[model samples]
Target: MRPEALALLAAACWAVAALFSAPASQRLGAIAFSRWRMLFASLILWGIALASGGWRSLDASAFGLLALSGVIGIFIGDTALFACMNRLGPRRSGVLFATHALFSAVFAWFFLGERLWGWALVGSGLLVAGVMLAIVWGRRGDEQHGWEQTRGRLAVGVALGLLAALCQSVATLMLKPLMASGIDAVAGSALRMSMALLAHGLLLSTGWRGARPLAPMRLRDAGLIFGSAAVAMALGMTLILQAMKHGQAGLVAVLSSVTPILILPVLWLVYRRRPAAGAWLGAALAVTGTAFILLR
Candidate 1:
């Protein structure tokens, strides 16, 4: 499959993971949940890497780079994202996080000398605009989590979301050159997860302000966290690495930003209600933009 296709698949995986993670995050606290999730995901990825001999290709430099990427992306970016979700709820947080696509494009242009032109550029704009539209205006029944209750923390949440976007963009851009140079995506993912786990663990150990006391893991919470780790951190991240390995980083980021749009159908199925018309229209625009991006 093409890297673009893989990126889209990653988006879908993230959409599913978000559903499982939101409630758990609310219960567990963002910092605690993120730490545990990274630990769980690292263990799973390590098992896969060891079994498949995926670790054979990495030298010291590649390993270090992957580890750094993991710290920035998984630890910093994801922790902030979960915090944003906790404060602003999924809809607002997701829309804010989607700015990672723009950050990735700018970083790729400045650092990697990658550029988009013609249809790809237009598509990227439309895709981002569509997602913003869907998130800003699409609301149906109880699915809406308005910012009214979060008015006090709105500024903080937005700041964290922006931080997450910047961290994620830099992390992905940093990994692109290494991935393109033939790093094993699975091993690289495992390495990054491990590093992120360590970083979070250290922060917890140091009593960082962001770190919260973890509630005892109940069976249901364990299941949710494990499922989220397996799908989002392990599989989704590996797919992202693969996409960056073969595709332009900017294009991959923009395509993967469709996670919010993809979540609409999932929500409809789970809640047994249809999304608002704006959602449908936004989905159409996002799809049309993706088509433009994919077109030569």
Candidate 2:
């Protein structure tokens, strides 16, 4: 498939993953769900790596980079994101995550020397503004008016979102160097998941006090969540890394800025949820701006 197609496919898969994961978060708790999700992803990626090549094909440096990426991006970024979810709620957290594009662009610029054009700058600004508008104006089922009951959570959400963005940016920036040095994307992804596994283990051991046992789940729910995890987080990330290998970082970043749009339709379908008109408009604006940035 073409790089753009792959990136869009990845985005779609990520959206599907989020659909199943929201309920899982409510059931198993976010930390537990995240850990198990990574565990499953690690196993899947590991098998793919082994099928493609023996373990010996992975070098120490590549392993190190992947490991670091996994820990920082998956464990730290994801954990902080879950916290943001609790504090900011999904709508606000969703908007904050749009910041990842800006952070990623900056990281790519400094480390990879990826240049942004004038339209790209304008588009990114619009995208950020759009997402913020969406969050600020969006209303939930519980909220009759937009921005209701978001007092303390907003501040915490912003901080956590910034942390998530920083970790994600650093991890993404590291990918270019690793791939340039000849790391196989599949094997690298496997190693990254392996690091995530270790981090999950640590979190379970130290971070999750009074963690609940795995709850009994319906076969349908289990299947959906697992499928989502494989397709969204693991497969999507692999495709994204592959696209980065073949495409410009700025373009890839711009395309990825539309993940929340991919997310909205899925949420509507699965949960019968809909964003407020303002939120929808904001998302549209963000996508429009991001598109301009990429195309120009």
Q: Which model scores highest in TM-score?
A: 1
**Model 2: per-residue lDDT, tens digit, 182-283?**
566777777787788787786567745634435655666566667756986779888877877776665566566566666666556655667779778988
TM-score of 2: 0.83
Q: What does candidate 1's lDDT look like per residue over 1-296, in tens digits?
A: 89999999999999999888987888888989998898889899989988999889788988788888998998999999988988887777888999999998888898889899999999998899899888777676566343213634689999999999999899998999899999899999999999998988888788786587456778899899999999999999999999998999999999999998987787677667788888888888999899998885
Clashes of each: 0, 0
TM-score list, all predictions: 0.95, 0.83
Worst 10 residues of 2 by lDDT: 144-153
Cα RMSD (Å) between model 1 and the true structure?
Answer: 1.8
